[model samples]
Target: MSLEQSSIRDAAIKAPGRRSPAANAPSLESLVSTARALVPRLRERGQQTEIERRVSEETNQLFHRAGFFRLMQPARYGGYEYGFTALLDVISEIGRGCTSSAWACSLGTIHQWLLGLFPAQAQDDVWGKNPRAIMCGSYSPITAAEAVDGGYLIRGKWRFASNVDNSPWAVLGVQLPEENGAGFLLAPRCDWSIEDDWHVAGQAGTGSKTVVIDKPTFVPGHRKLTFAEAASGAPPGAAVNPNPLYSIPFLSAIPVCLVAPLLGTAQGAIDAFVELCENRVTRGGIGGAGARLGQFAHVQSRLADAAAAVDAARLVLDRDITDVELTAAQGRRVSVETRIRNRRGHAYAAKLSHSAVQALFSCVGGSSLALDQPVQRMWRDANAIAQHITLNWDAVSTMVGQHMLGLEPKGAY
Candidate 1:
C-alpha cells in the first residue's frame, strides 16, 4: 500500500470519536465591545510591540484570557464558533489601536477556524489537550516532503510566519511530490525552529519571522489538509463538525481576512489626521500661519475624500461578508464567479484604504514623518498590509479580468 494510504489506515485504527460539548456561544456584540475596550492597551503597547518585532507576551495572554482565540473555534473545543464577520469586526476594532496587534490576533485565531476544517483526528490532536491553543502558519508551499511509512518526512524553511513565537502549533504549507499538488501539514512547536528574521518598516510588531524545519519531520495523514479540499471548503472535519461556518471557501474567506486590518489601519490614519488638524496650527502654508490645519479648504477636501474612500471600503467588505455567510448557511458552495467577485472586492478595498491613508499622510506634513506619530505608523502599516500578495490590487484585478475573459485565473485564489 502507498505510504499515504497506510497512514490513513493507521489513523483510522486509533481515531478518537470525541463529542464536543454544548455550544457556549458568545454574542458578537459582546466580543466587539471587548475588542473596542482593548484599543487603549493595544495602542499603548504599539511602540513596544514594534521595537520588539512582536506583540508582547503579556498582550498575547490578555487576548487569550479574553476568549479572542476562541472566536471561531469549534463549540466542542470551547470555541464560540462566531460568524465569519465577527472576526472582521473584532480585528478592525483592535486594528484601530495597533495594526500589528490586530494582525497577530487575527491570524492566530483564524488558524483556529482553519483547524475546524481539518479532519476530526487533527482537531482532536491539537484541541484535545488545550482547546485554546493558538496556531501560526506560512501557507505558501516552500517545503519539501518525502513519503514515509505513515506520513511524509518534510524539510524546509517557511518565512513570513506571523506570530510564530506566540504559537504552539503551526500549519506549514508543502508541495506533495507524488500528487504534484499542495497540502498543509500540522506540526507541533518541537518539530520546528524559529529564525528571527522579521525586520521591516511597517507591521514590524507582527513578528513574522522564518520557521525552519531542518530535520525530516514526520506528519501523519490525518494531519494533512489538501489545497483542493481547503479551496473547496469541504474538509473532512466539516463532515463531522457539521457547521456552516466552515463551509466558506478558504480563498474567498482569506482575502477578506487580509483586508480587514488594512481597513482599520486606514481609519486609524484618518482619525489621527483629523485630531491633528483640529489642534495643530500651521506655521506657514496656503492656510497661513496661526490657522488650524482643519480650517484650510485643501485639508477639508482631502479629509472628505479620505473619509469617503474609507467608508466605501468598509461597505464593500460588509457586503462580501454578508454574502459569504448567507451562502455558507444555505450549505451552497461559493461559485467561482462569486469567488472572483470577492477577490476583486477584497483587493479593491485595500487599494481604497491605502489611498485614504496616503491622502491623510500627505497633509500631515513633516511632523507626521516622526516615528512616534500615530498617523505615520498607520500610514506605514496600511501600505505594508496592502502590499500583501493576497490583497495586491494589480494582481487581483488581473485575475478577475482573466476570469471575465474566460481564461483560467492565475494563482490559488
Candidate 2:
C-alpha cells in the first residue's frame, strides 16, 4: 500500500451512536415518528406519485428537511449515525403509505452508510461541499473501465439507477477482472446523463431510469471500492469513520434496506384491506349485495394467513439485524455461515412479504385489477421488489441451500 493509503487507514478517532447529532438535530425516535406522521400525506399523494412516474420533488424535499436521509449517515458529516434498526423503522413506515417514496428514501439513506465504506478522499469529494448530497447506483456490472493515469476511464450505459433525479453522484459497477476485482466506480453528476425511460407495469414511481456515460469519463482511484473490499468488514473507511456499524460485512446486512420496504408495504396493504373488509359487500350473486366481506370464512382465512406471514417476515428480519449489530459491536468478523444465513433471511422475508401482498390483492376480487386502489399498487410494488437481483429468491435460496447441504455455493455473499 502507498504511504498515503497506509496513513489514511491508520489514523482513527472515536465516534459512536450515542454521540449526539449537531445541536437541534432530530433524534432517532423523532425521525421514525415523523415517518409515521407522514403516512397519511404520502397515501394522499400515492396516485399522483405513481402518475408522475417518479417521487415528486416536494416529497423529496420533505425527506431532506426532515433529516430522514441522515439515518445511517456518518456523524462527522452532519448526520444522525443511526443503525439499521432505525433505518428499518423509518423506511417501512414510509412504505406503508407509498411504496415509491419509501423506496427512494430508503436508498438515499442506506447509500450514505455504503459511501462511508469508501476512502476518505472519496467521502470528502461527495459530502464536503454539500453534506446533503445523495448518491444513486447501478451495481450490475455491464460497463468496462480502462486503466488510466490517476484511476480509470469508463464508458457504458447503466440501467435501474434509482432516484437519479435526486442524486448528484452515482457509483456504478465496473469489471476489473484482470485484478480479480469487481469495482464500484463513483461518477460525478456532470459525467453522466439520465434517460427518462423507467416506464414499467410495477414500480413506476421508482424512476429507476437509465444512466448513460457515452463519452469516456475519468474517475480518480480514491472513488472506488471493489466487492471484495466491501465484504472485508473493515474497509478503508472504517479507519476514519470508527463507528462499529462500519465493521459489519457488506452483504450480511445491507440487504435489510431492500427488504424493509417490502415488509412495511405489506403491513400497510393489510391495514388498507382490513378497512375495506369492514364496509365491503358482495354483489350480484347468491350472497347478494348485503353479504359483508369480512364475514366470509374464506376471506377471514386469507387475512389470517397473510397477517401471520407478515409477522413471521418481520421477526426474521429483526433477528438477522440483531445478529449483524451484535457481530459488529463485538468487533468480530461475521462468519460465512452467518453471511449466508442473513442472505437467506433477506430473501425469505421478501418472499413472504410479496406473498402476503398477493393474497390481499387477490381478496379484493375485481378490485385486484384496479389501479386506483392502494392494495393493488402495493401488490405491484411488492412484485417489483421481488424482481430485484439482490432479492431474487430462487437464486438466493439455491445458494444458501447449497451451503446448508455442504456443497459449494456460488455468487452473492
Candidate 3:
C-alpha cells in the first residue's frame, strides 16, 4: 500500500466507534411499535406510491414524526443509535405493507448510518443545522472528480439514487482523477439537477430518479470517503462518532441493508396468499361444494414451501448482521473472509426470499394478477430487488466458492 493509504487505514482502525456523552434517544421498542403501526397505512398507500413513482409526502412525514429515520443515526446528533438489526426489522415490517415504500424508507434511513462515516465537519455540514436531514446515494462510480485546491471538482450524472427526492444532500460515487481508488463525493441537493426519469415495473415508489450535476461542483476534502477506507471496516467518522454501528464493513452492510425489504416483500406475499386461500373457495373441485382453497394439497404445499424459504432467508440474514455487529462491539475489524461470507449469505437470503415470493405468487391464482392485488405487487417488487448487483446470487455464490477454494474472492463484494 502507498504511504498515504497506509496512514488512512491506520487512522481508521485506531479510533473506531467511540461513544460520546450520553444523549436521550428514543427506545427501540417505541420505534418498533411506531413502525408496526404504520404498516397498514403503507399497504393502503402502496398503489398510490407506485402511481406517483415515489413514496408520498404524507408517508414521509409520518415516518419523520415517528422518528424512523433516527434508528441508525448517531446519538450525539439527536439520533437513537439503535442496533443495526432494529433498522432491518423496521424495513422488513414496512416491506410487509409495501415493498416499494419499504425500499425507499430503507435507503432513505440508512443514509444516516452512511453519514456517520464522513469526517466530523462533513457530518456537521449535514446534521448540524438540521439533525433530521436524510440523504441518498448512487454507489456506481460514474461521476468524474478532478483534484482542486481545497477539495475536488466533481461533475457528472448519477442514476438510480433512491429516495433522493426526500433528501437535502446526496453522495455520488466518483472516480478521483488523481487517486487510484474510487470514493464518494458529497454534494448539496441544490448543486444537482434531478431528472424525473424513474419508471419501472417494480419498486416504482422508490423515486430512484436520475441526479445530474451539470456544472462542476467543488466538494471539500472532508466530504470524500475512499472505497478502500470504507471497505477497510473503519471510516474517518468512527474517530468522532465511535459507534459500533459505523464500524461494520461498508460492502457487507450494503447488501444487508438492501435485503431487508426483499425479505418483507416475501413475507407480504405469504400473508396475502394465505388470506386469499382462507377466504376463497374452489368454484368446483373434487372436494365438493364449500371447499376452501386453503384445504387444497397444492395450496398447502406451496404455502409450506414459501414459508420455509422466508424463514431460512431471515435466519441467514439475521445471523450475518448479528455477527457483524458483534465484531464491531468487540472493536475488531471483520476479516475479508467473513465479509465475503456475509455478502454471499445476504445475497443467498435475498435469492431465497425471491423464491418464496415467486412460490406464493404462483399459487395466488389468476385473479390475484390484477394490478391492485398485493400479491402481484409483491411479486414484481421482489423480482426487481433481486436484480440489484449486491444481491446477484449467481455472482456472489461464485465469489464465495472461489474463497472457499483458497482463491482470493473476486469482484467488489
TM-score for each model: 0.93, 0.93, 0.92
What are the per-residue Cα lDDT tens digits for candidate 3 across 85-202?
6777778888899998888888878888888888899999999999998888898997678999989998788999998788889988999776777998888888998999999999
Which residue pairs of candidate 1 clash?
none
By summed lDDT, the worst window of 10 consecutive residues in model 2 runs over 9-18
**Model 3 weakest lDDT span, ten residues long:** 12-21
Candidate 1 regions off by >4 Å?
1-22, 285-287
Error of 1 at 103 (Å): 0.4
Off by over 4 Å in 3: 1-23, 284-290
Q: 258, model 1: CA deviation in Å?
A: 1.4
Local error of candidate 3 at residue 15 (angstroms): 22
Instruction: Give the Å shift of residue 67 in candidate 2.
Output: 1.0
Instruction: Name the lDDT value of residue 408 in candidate 3.
Output: 83
CA shift at 210, candidate 1, in angstroms?
0.4
Clashes of 3: 3
Give Cα-based local distance difference scores for all models.
0.83, 0.84, 0.82
- Where does candidate 1 have its weakest 10-residue lDDT segment? 12-21
Q: Write the per-residue lDDT of candidate 2 for residues 191-288, one digit (tens) a residue.
A: 99999999887878877888999988889989988888899988989988888888788888888889988999999999899988987877836544
